[model samples]
Target: MMLLLMLIADLLILSVHGWIVYKTTKIECFPNARYIRNATCGIKAVNRYRSHTNMESDIVNKLRNVSLNLQIFLRNSANKFKPFLVNVTANLCSILDKRNFPAYTTIVMNILKEVSNVNHSCPFTHPLSTHQQKRLIVKNLYMDEKFMPIVPPLGLYKIDFNFLEGYPYDDVGTVILYIQVTDVKEFKLRTKAPKFVYSTIIYKTLSIECKYNPEILTNVTCQLKPINWQKSVCIWDADIPHSLKNISIHLQLFKIYGANNFLPFLINTTLNMCDVLSKRSFSVYGKILFTILKETSNINHQCPHEEHLSLYNLYVDARLVPVTLPLGIYKAVVRFLEGYPQVFIGTTVLNLEAMEKRERRGKVNKN
Candidate 1:
């Protein structure tokens, strides 16, 4: 009975040992509680990765669109007053090394200028992308100061984001700014003659355009005006009679001037001597007399202040030449007649010295 019991115990012990080994192998081969947990975690990780990939794909698409818009802006503003083309480029590195992704998924652009080699950051913030991701990162970019003055007076500007050094790509992206400067114009009255005179009717049209914004051509405003009426051509009084009532119908005072304060006044008068002597045929008989007087009775008696006009028979005209006098207010009296006795038909007064003094004062004040 003891030998039979020992054989049975040995068989039971071997079966138990084999059964433990089988159970451990079955736990490893088939799904257990720990295997189920690991599978569930793996599924979640795969879904997260898919979602991240989709987000990156979207960002890349949007950046491409940005590049297109930038090109359009540059094309439209190409004709503007830009001295030269300003080109800037930078690299947008991926923050995640495992996958090529932007460190700062949210792209921001800023324009800046430097002062004495020191960079002064701009206040404007340009948003290039708005996609959100699992990780956020940022990179610092340095802008060269040489590009600061390349902007045109009016037109759109574009900032290019290059992924491959200086080459442009849709994945890297771009920024744009549409700037329109103001326009203006100005007008003033002027004279055709070297010196303006109230009696003269000759005028010249003066138009001035503002140069502040040369790029914008439409909607210009006239903001400038003549500051001094005396310096303008339209300073003559409108109420003054167009025709001098007492002046002779045959003789008209065409012009009165001097050799820039060095010579005597040359008073030119237009007369119908040509028409009058056209009938006379051979010779025209007429005499013109003129006299000069000073305001302060400070006449230089030695000066030849009185003279008879010279008759230019070729043109049927006459002129009065008065000797030069001291710088002061003065006037000239002119008379025209036809007969030997000299009939006084008309007379004119010239204030050349007075006008000269006024002009001199104006220049002094201007200086």
Candidate 2:
């Protein structure tokens, strides 16, 4: 502003001097007289007379160049503000054996990075399962590699016990869930996600038959727990009948799962087995067929059976019947032995599991 004012003052001074020069001499020399508008001087002499040397038009051009430079600088700064990038993967782990360790603690991040930082997070266990199971807190996790930031972010790190195992084993066998980790933000259908789930039991409980008196039929409720990995599918016995009521009530148990596979064979085998079963004369020859029920599941191989496989003998010491296979609610049952204590009635689990298998497959969307 001060320079502008000075330039104005200087222009005024130059105009007055030019006016004086013209008025005092040049106009006097030529008397027909032009006005101030008409008065003129040499261009170089006029410009030199009006301006300070330092505040020349060259300076204005330099100021314009500075403005252009500032604009370019601002544009480059805006480019840096685009977007920050981070990559995330999924986590799902279920353990059958505590001693067995996971394969990978972290997955290999495949995403490429350029301008910004890429964050690949370690697998985090889900809060619900941990709380539900009240199991061990997952340990030995890492940040970069030894959890150090120095390790490269692109590669995979050892999880020591990654739960995305291809081989699945269900502990209690209700449901197994597997979680599939993914690098992208959107979930993929094709990607095999992680889940821990119970594979449907292809078979359950083994069966054998024992026959006893219907009047003395007794069952002792015993917990069928697997000891040392041994399995007890089912047991069938149609020895002697007490009252028809005892056979019906006692035989009610012994259920089976997925009946489509083994029920027919069991029924066929039990019927044939009973036909040949020699009965002690005077004791009603009878048999009751049943399928066992043991859904309290785990990852183990138990053969399928239609029902308790049983044998029936009549005309024996009636008192010994209670002592021999003494029954209140034994795991095994004797359903039909004709001419025995109770008249033989017929029921079989030939198709008990067929409907169940179809329903479960539909539920899982196995197709």
Candidate 3:
């Protein structure tokens, strides 16, 4: 009986040892591979667990496939809605309540970032000139890959600009925000040559009461209009100041659109600057003398246009008109001139070398 008990004890020890080894080496099977961890089950139930695990994996795969397909569908739908998105982004400020200006601005900026290709380069720094054929290539300011993982669909984007530090007065130039959008469908054409588009610019005032007055432009309302349209015909007008009667101030606004057309329309003067310069157009004008020999004894001559005194006639240059001005920036302020209520036309920088002079010296030569 004692011998039999010893043998039973030895068998029990072997079984426990085998069970511990099996538990340590057990392979855990999960329906979803993501949930697999430490697992131990007896050999008898291994096949049963695997059967359930396979079914669970199949179900997880099907769900994953559905999720992937849904993602693709949403992306395609967003592409279709991209153009409308751009319009909505541009018109956000118009639709939002006036009181929620901060929120409206934030949303618009976020939308712009989502749609725009991020470009960290400095703003374009070309001084706008009216005397030359000005051609500009409008593109995104930033094109960061992290901000823009996918390229936005090609379409027309309406860019809005404003000043950050409020409207600057004369002598201190204003810093205007420059926002720009490019065409989407015309990308191929844009790649070859820039295409122009027409858009409306609505001027506003700082307050609702000042809406009727375009002159009181707040930082938000003050922005330069895009120059993509055809050039306007410039008509020079004569302005005689009370102080200087002889000196004629040539008032000419930088190209007024729709004014030259057959249709009678006034330019949006609030957005324009009717510059006044001291130079006279008469200086550029020339006169010529003409003589014709007639078949008869009498000679006939016709002068082309009005003739001005020339060097041939020993005409002396007109006496220099000296108009004394203080050492300060001077601008001709013309108000209510363009039919707009209180429209103020101002001049930009008129540099004078005599008043503000700087001496230049060559770098010290090392002998």
Candidate 4:
């Protein structure tokens, strides 16, 4: 009886262990190898939150290059997006959304981990410092014509800045801006460089003096505070403000979708801004540039005729045809919408037709 009882006990223990391994690691346990194979893989599953910090300058530069091209591509597609996608193990977005995909999910989650660690090592003490791109990791603050969140796609966010002097672009006195977010939720940042050299990244920061106007951020100055990065996205744990009502912000990001051109259009933006918020286009990033096509002319457009296109709804960017293009992919970045909230925000209301040219232009005219 004692021998029989021992065998039963051993079998029960083995069954429980197998169950534990299954949940910890979703992969199936192999016969006679449950304890062996599963344990190795199980560690990875258990440590989904696991990430390594990479501050090495060379690695950081490689990441930045990838980021730059991503932003430009994204801009032509949508209006806004988050910068680096962090928070591994968590589904960053809704699975039900059409944009969601399994492959993209895996690829981005890994990039999030890699870039977050690298950015945490921001080397330069000054945001305007040489070879240093001022990181723009602010609480998201923009609303679309529908008053929807303008979160950008592919996690690409725009800093919307010109290079400042004493920096790389000193000759032009224009400041080029870029930003990176970390994975873990803390306040210290780190960086590594070539030449086997190590350096600490620091920044002196400004505070949100008043929270009353989250969207109406203006006339305030951000002196970079020497900061240590934590896994948390904010610097010095400085809390980011959220929009209460409709707000006006320069750093705007929206998802880019090739199928939806109207969604990107910002209509009567100057008057809308002035009338709605008593503000004008304040983006130092450059004027709002957009590509326009005509609705009636069998070409992509704001409207069919001159009266409607010129008088009421015209592409604010002087370069846009507001008349016609050669029938190819183009962009439309409306400078400022004046009578904003009170009035309609996009060209949607006009019910324009599409020229939807495929090969008219190979690339956007950068001029």
Writing each residue's lDDT as its tens digit, candidate 4 over 257-323 gives 4675433322112222221222233221212221122311122222111111122223223232122
Q: State the lDDT at 87 in candidate 2.
A: 13
Winner of 2 and 3 under TM-score: 2
* lDDT, each prediction: 0.21, 0.20, 0.19, 0.21
Model 2 per-residue lDDT at 209 = 36
| Candidate 2 local lDDT, 60-97, one digit each (tens) | 11010000000000011333311111111112222111
Instruction: Give residue 161's error in model 4 in angstroms.
Output: 12
Model 1 lDDT tens row, 53-139: 000112122121111111112324346432112222223222111122121111221211111110112111123434332111121
lDDT of 1: 0.21
Candidate 1 TM-score versus the reference: 0.16
Task: Identify the superior model by lDDT, candidate 1 or candidate 3.
Answer: 1
Pairs of residues at least 3 apart in sequence or in different chains that clash in candidate 1: 94-101, 95-103, 103-137, 104-137
RMSD of 2: 40.4
Model 3 lowest lDDT segment of ten = 64-73
lDDT of 3 by residue, 10-58 (tens): 1111111101110111212222222111222111223211111110011
- State the weakest 10-residue window (summed lDDT) of model 2: 64-73
Off by over 4 Å in 1: 1-83, 92-151, 156-177, 183-367
